[model samples]
Target chain A: MAQMADKGETFPATVENRGGTGRIVLCCEHASNHFPAGWGDLGLSAEQRLAHIAWDPGALALSRRLSASLKAPLVHAPVSRLIYDLNRPPFSAGAMPARSEIHDVPGNATISAQERAARMRAIYLPFHTALHDLLAERMALGLDPVLVTVHSFTPLYFGKRREVEFGVIHDDDPSLARAIVKAAASTGLRTGLNEPYSAGDGVTHTLKLQATPYGLPHAMLEIRNDLIHDDQSVARMAELLTPVLNMGLAEIQRQAKAS
Target chain B: MAQMADKGETFPATVENRGGTGRIVLCCEHASNHFPAGWGDLGLSAEQRLAHIAWDPGALALSRRLSASLKAPLVHAPVSRLIYDLNRPPFSAGAMPARSEIHDVPGNATISAQERAARMRAIYLPFHTALHDLLAERMALGLDPVLVTVHSFTPLYFGKRREVEFGVIHDDDPSLARAIVKAAASTGLRTGLNEPYSAGDGVTHTLKLQATPYGLPHAMLEIRNDLIHDDQSVARMAELLTPVLNMGLAEIQRQAKAS
Candidate 1:
């Protein structure tokens, strides 16, 4: 067991895996707000630098806790989503956004065609390849892989306060999502079937590419960032989510075998 | 008739008109291949920097001569097409191309949504707004405006040599296009009525946004760079094109009067 999977920060997008034999794979694509210092904070003010436009604040921390709890491998992107959103496809406009909410990214204001291709090669391709390779290796080893991407959303968007605390996002597969939502409801979490963000809004790039093609049991969790901001809260949330995920996967397998 | 039109490079895209009372308006959107100094030459080698990938070579030079003879307004984008193609809409992938032919733009490789919006605000929107305002202002003054965009293409693309020396591109406007094609063919020039590129291929963002919505007589002229790579070639080509454009506009006007 390789303890951790760090493909390096130079490539921007990287993964840190706590080596485990579990079939559940946890992915945190927007895991950090660390843009390589070469970008000069992406020409953002200090306030904007720490804003949700840069990264989902508590997602990585929560995913780490869950990964540890479930004994699952976590593949994460180390660069800021402001640098390149790993959750978006190379052709997606949001993959390399020019604006998010009210803030603007000045560094990407006027780029050349050559510069675009370089980022695709350096950050985007590497991160996706690593995830794909990891999943492929597990399948080759005769282990079933369940894909789960951990995410956190802002409680407010465009000045509108969001209502749901937990969102179960999926692509064409509803078994895992429905199960997680059902269990989370029992835990008293204000759960949404696909509220806050829908998979149709082009938010499922990672899951669509990695999970749908393989027909793997997959679901992306969008927790409210405010709830998981602290370490204790993250751990507590993980504890609540771990049992749900395990049960959800067990049910999926049971149904698969029955079918 | 005013003699010259050059709006400078500070705002990047601006209108320079000779203040001619004629209905014809000239534009050279991919006019310059001059990417500003800050982006580290977009990670392109010196050779690649000067190639057609940076800008449509000879397009601006030819436009200058055409503007001189036509005595019409010429709107231009001073930044390199490699930076942000002014001929394309902000949402178009080619607007900030990550890849151009075999060359890739490193600067645009990993842009943020903020960056995309910045480019739109800084480069894309400004150019379109200026052009739109120019047309609106002319119409406001009770003057009919005929839009004409100037462009140049490579003789060889992807290792294959091309035959057409000129392409008259249009956006659903057949009157001006038919006139230009007939006039161009009469001059012993090998002309293609929308060859190498078609307006349907998303290449007519300028004409679509500026021309079609207004039902103005408009057409895009695509000259071969090999045919106008230098001062002598540019002058000769301009000399051949001037009378054709004047005659084309006259025919359009005549047809309008009859219809």
Candidate 2:
């Protein structure tokens, strides 16, 4: 898996799978928390820098730990989110954000059509291809893998405070979300059912394009940034969420058999 | 359509279709012939530089002419093929060509994931979305449009010359290809039966992905670059092709009625 950094230098992208028997594929779309060298700060202060707008901070650590603990394959994008957001549909208006928040993306403005095609060929296609290949391979091997995408949300957005500590988002398959919501409730943690964003808007990628098309059970877990700001917090959240994920997977299997 | 170019500069990469009624959707994946400013001249002499590798050479002009004459909506990519070959599958090995012929594409050597995703979003997706939207609109209006992709291929590749003046390539829809071949034969032009390339392999893109899924009749028209080098030639070819295409469309209608 560590070879991805080196391979990424030569190839456009890489997908790594740690050894696992469980049929749960883990993905972190905005995993990279590093900007390219010499980008010389995005012209934002330190506090303003670490917010959700910049990157999906701390989710990578939790995803890595979860992948290790569960022995499942993990697919992550190594580039900074500011460059291109993988979660947004390739044709979405927000795909190439010229001006994000108060900061202007100077690199993206006035790009030629050729330059745009080059970017898509190199990054977006590879990531989606890897995910597609992995799912196809697992399914071919008779493994009905459940996809779980890990992400983090900011405590506040646009000067408004967000009270949700955790969110369970699903567009089609409600089995996993229902399990997680129930588990979180039993643990006394207030969970939001698609609080930050609703899956009903028809704006989706990765999970929607890859998983939903196959009718596979999947869920997007959004943990508030404040909840996973540090290593200890990340580990604690992983531990807390582990059982919920496991139970959800088991219930998915049970439901699949029942149907 | 004129409104599009003016608005495109301000809202670049936005996609809108020409409102239409014809039951034929024209697509030109490699429509734009552009190179980034200052590409060190690609190290090729003028003759080799002007070859089909730089672009599809004359496809966009022909497609526009066909769209106008046939009153069919056309969906085209505004980016250079060198940036990302829109005709190739997003994840196909050739999606981002590192080297074309002997000319080295220096800019493509080490693209970051972020830059790649940006390209997919900015160019590839918009082209496909435009085509998909046009098809969906036609379907909604109860128009069973046959997809006709217009492309121009080089007269020769490597060292051998291609004798065929035109090729009608189709995979599952042999009915359309058979009709076009018969029509072209009736005109006494030497046509290649999937010459230059085969639909069985090395053939994919929006046409296959978008059209085949809907079971719509589709065929790709590959005219040798030598045949369509000038405006007169393109007009001549389009004139010859209109009857052939119409014959194929009629055959498809017959098949639909029979089924």
For all candidates, state DockQ relative to the true structure: 0.01, 0.03
lDDT of 1 by residue, B17-53 (tens): 5476678888888877676654447677788878888
Task: Provide all candidates' interface root-mean-square deviations.
Answer: 20.8, 12.6
Instruction: Using lDDT, give the best candidate's number.
Output: 1
TM (B chain), model 2: 0.86
lDDT value, residue B209 of candidate 1: 61
Clashes of 2: 5
Clashing pairs in 2: A116-B119, A119-B116, A120-B119, A120-B120, A123-B116
**Docking level for model 1:** incorrect
Across A1-259, the per-residue lDDT of candidate 1 in tens digits comes to 1111232334734556646778889898888787675455767888887778888888989988887878888888867887778787544557667788888787766544444444555576567667765665564344678899999999889999998999999887889998888777678889998777888787887887677645578999999999998899998888889898888888888889999
TM agreement with the true structure for every prediction: 0.49, 0.52
| lDDT of candidate 2 over B147-257, digit per residue (tens) | 888888877677678788788887555777777887888666678777767765666455555675455778888888887888998888788887777777787788779
